[model samples]
Target: METREHSATAGPDVAPPVLTRIPARMDRLPWSRFHWLVVVALGITWIFDGLEVTLKGAISGVLQEPGTLHFTSAEIGSITSFYLAGAVSGSLIFGYLTDRLGRSLFFFVTLAVYLCGAFLTAFSWNLWSFILFRFITGMGIGGEYAAINSAIDELVPARLRGRIDLIVNGSYWIGAAIGAASTVILLDPAIFPVDVGWRVGFGVGAVLSLFILFLRRHVPESPRWLVIHGRSDEAERIVSGIEGQIEKETGATLEEPEETLAIHPRKSFGFGVIIRGMFTLYPKRSLLGLSLMVSQAFLYNAIFFTYALILTRFYHVPAGKTGLYLLPFALGNFCGPLVLGRFFDTIGRRQMIAGTYTVSALLLALTGYLFTVDLLTPFSQTALWTVIFFFASAAASSAYLTVSEIFPMETRALAIAFFYSLGTGAGGVVAPWLFGTLIGTGSRMAVFYGYLAAVVLMLAAAVIEIRIGVKAERISLEKVAEPLSAKK
Candidate 1:
């Protein structure tokens, strides 16, 4: 084995390529406080995202009031679309940077961007400023998804990867639950003025985000990424530090790592390589990734983003009271992944993913039919969605898990960004616009049609999973897909 640094601006900078034990060292470690720190620091981004999104949904009705920004229904939907647009743009721009610049750098940069956008959103005076600020916030979150998912997958032992990834992704709903409850208090007429309440919602997200910044600074760079990017010495040092800490924490000597991979350390990898890898080298996995991403994005953004609007518009639920309903919905979503996550590792990815997706789709169809027939009260409607999303949430989280693990390590962040941007573009951005239009029509059948569309996409994703889902459970990422930089 050899370790050396290469300088930038030297043409085709290359170091002595050799076998490295970094990935094996990481994968063989026992559960330790270090893992918890990584989970909390990087995983908390989902919570902030959930908080940002739920706060927006919770305050959507407030924004429509005469005393507030007085946004129209279409304007409300447009705001979500703007957020998705910014996310798409950010994922592409920052995701490439994440792969190029390293995970640790982008996580801090992205969070700072989010905090700025979120704080500025509190001061929004008009619809334009609010939407613009939301877009900026979305950009921050979009980048977080790219960087954090790659880091988590790379660092976690393959045995625990599925459960941890699902649980971390599902933590979004814990923040959703918090945002929903907070909105109930903030939007209360006795507690705060209608105009004042909504600004406070955005302010709370920004404030909470600040605490996460301190924790993120402690999480180290991915050792896998480091070794592959011509920084083997740093990778070795970081991994060794983690092992020392883990042994101290557990008070046990660690076993030696048995597997090591030989990799060529390249200073630069081009987009052409990634593009060719996706389309030519691994085509089926690419399709599977897209299918999962698109379906879940459409379903979640279409419904969750507009829950308040639907309650206020059709169900006539009070704006302030919307959180009460969303509370239960959030609970169901959060619990799904926590409870069902282990199955992805134990029962296997294909069966569990397909089962969850199929069941959720069926429930959505049933709920849509009942909704169109005017048989559901606001309480019952929420209850049905709760049951539906319980499964859907786990399935949705799996989509992220799938993309992160199935691709070559060299292109992992970009692949996630590609699928997320593409999926969110096709499903996430468009669904909100379509649903907002449907809800504005004041026709139950129109909204039912929207539900049916979600059903079809989910069903397609389920079928795709059954046919081509990678049995990636309990398998190291390098085994899942050989690293692009692996020496022949």
Candidate 2:
């Protein structure tokens, strides 16, 4: 039997810690192993995601090559938009499929399809074909967010979920770092033609996909998913097998854990069931989606679209050096979640959300000021960018985890994809256009970013008002999902 720890911090009148019974053991080494797989998978996914981030518009020089396929700047921008469309569709379609068809299958298929798209995109004969293939690849990237996050929610123990989720999300920045590094390593202009740089970058994603697919073979389907689908027999077997490992490790005498399972557990799924369940089970998640979509679309696109200008005009940074120039910035982003995530469960979700947002906003504003004042040295510029990037990355990490945990299992995948799409599609897609248009006059870019920072701070303010906020309980999918839909 597992022993419980009492919280002396709780008032004498407060209730004791209540444990949510799960199908398998949460204490064994396997739990950590399970999370490792997710972390690795996320890292791999981000590598490809990172490649997209790097290769998207970087091909301007390559496209200028006489023998290479030609693309107008407008056509190139359309391709990026096309990629975002794929992401939006992937989030909704693959998200629903993950829940209905089972996580393992969707995971495999999505990875495969994404890989093929990347391969096709790399070898495209024309800009149109490249756009088509890029869209296909992006769908996989979009699907990955929902599929990976849902799997994490269902499989990880609640208490560790927040921290783990933060870690997983952080991998995307690691992808960015890798992307930047790869520019220097794989695409050195002296040794390799610029034409080969984009192709090499695309190839990296395809290779990474293969490795991730191979690693996923040993990963198990969520026990919670099985029980929900009414696969008691299979769920029991998985649970028992996990417990058997726990017995060998902890040597704690086991008692039958109390658990209630769904009846007529769904065996098969269809588009209709996924679509209906999405809204029915996740009414409130749309709010989160709106927030995330707005936040991501705004910040990411703004930074990406304007990076060259920011580095050159703001920091006196050279254009060619951009490849390795973002290291500090990426590092800050990479570290934010691991450092901040530890406190999310205990610190109160709203406070963390607000705090991180305020910090990020302030940092961005600081970067803008340095830019406007013409006071930027390369060293000082990089330092300021690093700190700001960290805050932004951490805040965004928390959002993804919160969204994943705050919906019912019935619509978990859809909720993840839906809101993510909104954030990335709406906020991300328009951010560049808005930033470019608004970034007129002196310090316009700074002021524009300042406005975005303010909006995030506003979101932080409103988070506390919502009753369904992040809680300290071991963040089980159950607590996050809410009983609103299941009660029906």
Candidate 3:
């Protein structure tokens, strides 16, 4: 297969159209060590996010101890909100920059920012300092979401995109489990001093990030992004390198791709173009993305962030043992995506997305009813939550999958950032704070009502998904959403 580039100088303002085989070349390649490298390097973003969130949740009780920060429940909730606020800001800022700069550049920059924030968090002297550092950490993870997802979707083969995306997103719980398990030792009174243990927990995230930075150095920029941005020479060189690597690993001749894409290469897309394309051109897709993101964000943020408090406040479970309970919850969440991810590709996106969302909602309603009736112990409560989130985790993972693939390549990262920022800003930023205040009231019914609201939003998302979700299974990204620069 050969790339054919033709410069169509229709006008001074218009970009020259270049017909290239980059997309088909990427989509048809067999899975190999190169793909695995991409997964490990890029997918670790979600793991770090999971670690940051679970670390805070695990240490919330420790922060409230008189010997430590002695923060109230409301203050703990506010700290979570501050982190999410920073995420919203970071996604918007870096998401656009990732599009303008390059995927390879921002992933490293974001990880470095996270390392700085997390390391600084270990030495926070007061409530404000802790919140400030946490906010900075959230910004890094938020930026990761936009840059990493776009890069993953572009590089991975079309046949495996759905499952790979789901599994990568699901890996967040691996970090969650790590955070929970580490706290069991870190927060223990016998193992470390009351204040010292919580500090080490923050340091763990920083240390892990420092390691990932070295690994990501080997990953390359997106060829698709390059070709469209008038860097076809670089794009061709990178794709040729990847193809050679994959062929060498398998020791087999690679088949040539049959299809090609024609793109009018440009320097960058304006924010206004992305906004108009998402809302004006793809309205239903925009709504579907928003609903899925908002519902899952609210459900996960509300329940997960405040779960330790629910145990301590209602069931009187000791704060030190909360990590033990979270272990099972994290296992259930991690397993959900691993088990159900393949079905997404086989069963199709529309059906699987709708089914998972609807099922999780119904399960949540039942669990909330059980809690309100006061017939369950801590063990039973955790058990039921584990079951509910089994499906909920998959549902949440699919939300990221939906937004990333359904838009034009030029707009992909910004679109993810826009929806993530909007959805997270609207739902995630307030859920923890709201649920924490509700849990503070010592009323099971109040907390149950919060769960009920999440159910409503989730069920609504299911209906919208059933109505208009894209059937993108096994389809090339270029085919799913034609590039904004594509020429007739």
Candidate 4:
């Protein structure tokens, strides 16, 4: 448990180098209640995001009713864009803070922000007010993406990081399913007034966030983040406590970790370091991260945000009944990661990421053609989407996984935030608005053309993966990409 701090060979003015085994100690521990606690507490971020999004999509039609806000399809799309804009800004602000401050601090802060935004959304009086509140809610969830992914990846054992991350990211659909199911009752005219029902739907997310905030109080700060920030003593204490707790729970002694890393511990890393790491130190990885993130974000956001609209506009499905179609779609999205996650750790990242992206793209293209030709019934179209997203979900989740684990520790959170913001900004913020406009045109061919664009991006990303994807499966994060401050 000893951490040695000594002057670097370079000079006295330089930050002292800390030689520590915190990462190995964490990676070698047996899976226990502690890991599950981390999963449930931090993993729920995706669920909340899924709920927020699905609720919005499911109620798009309801909001257009005269009893509600009377939003047009184009306005609904713009609202989704506003949410993405908030998320992009939040990720940048909180991501820098998470890297500089600590992961544990921001977890509570971001969730609290989301709670407030969701609660306020229930009381919005007009379209502008609703859009503003949704933006605020997006900020919280966006911050959660940067902080929670960094924290979870740092805390989990290296051997299990891949599957665990995929499962956790995939759990977004659990919230999607919940949102879809609840809207069925919440939006039903017989059960609640149209305006009141949509308001209650948003309130549900606030209540869920409150419970998750309580659970997060039990989760600890990441030892890896602590050690890199010149808090080696605190990191040692936390790791030892984790080891002791796990041993006590299992009633068995733990083995010593053989690996140790030497890093120059600094109080904070400047943006210059992040800029260099991304541009100078790891340009290829930067390209890879962006490609994966942008492709998936474009495909998912464009489709999911506009899904209910397509159902109502094209297939003439009832607004209240959209949730039933979404239930199966959500299930397919969830099951893809749960089922295919292990392969990323076994078959390896390059093959699986490339394979899934390519397969999903091909499927989507086929489905788009079917829709354009007017061959799909609403049930058949939903069935096709359920199948397509089965692969697309896994591909999308892997994008997050790749970005989080492929950067230096000093910049991990910010790197995640940067790529997430850039990709989401480029792909996510525009997709919903663009697709909404297309759907508003009332042309299946126009919508099919949009799907074709998404397919092109996915194919290009798959090619990039085949060319340069990291062999990160089952590898320690340190080995995946060495820390910027590491001393050879």
lDDT of 2 by residue, 1-488 (tens): 22233555433333233232443344222454546666686446665686677666556556656656767767777888899899899888898888777777877888988999998887988878998998999899989888888887676676677777777787777777777776775556677675676787887788878988999886778766765554555766766676676667667756664553222234554556555655655555555546644674567567766666656654556777765667777788779887888777677666676677667766666667656666777777678767876767777877787777776666677778877887886566666776655554446455555455645643553453244444634644555554222231
TM-score of each: 0.93, 0.86, 0.95, 0.95
Candidate 1 error regions (>4 Å): 1-12, 309-316, 439-446
Instruction: Write candidate 4's Cα lDDT for 1-488 as tens digits.
Output: 65556663734323677777788888888899999999999999999988988888778888888888898978987898889899998999999899889999999999999999999999988889999999999999999999999999999998889889999999999999998888768977899987899899889889988999999999999999888777888888888899999999999998987778888877777889777977798899999999999999899988887787899998889866777888999999999999999999999989999999999999999999999999999999999999999999999999999999999887888889999998888677778778988999999899989999999999999999999899999888999989877853
Instruction: Provide the clash count, candidate 4.
Output: 0
C-alpha root-mean-square deviation, each candidate: 2.9, 7.2, 1.9, 2.0
For model 3, what is the C-alpha lDDT against the true structure? 0.89
Q: Tell me the spans in candidate 4 whose CA falls farther than 4 Å from its real position.
A: 8-14, 70-75, 437-445
C-alpha lDDT (0 to 100) for residue 462 of candidate 2: 41
Which ten residues in a row are the worst by lDDT in model 3?
Answer: 1-10
* Best candidate (score: lDDT): 4
By TM-score, the candidates rank as 3, 4, 1, 2
Candidate 3 positional error at 101, Å: 1.4
lDDT of 1 by residue, 427-457 (tens): 7768877997899999999999999999999
After best superposition, candidate 2 residue 136: deviation in angstroms? 1.0
Where in model 2 is the C-alpha error above 4 Å?
A: 1-30, 249-256, 259-264, 268-285, 314-316, 440-468, 482-488
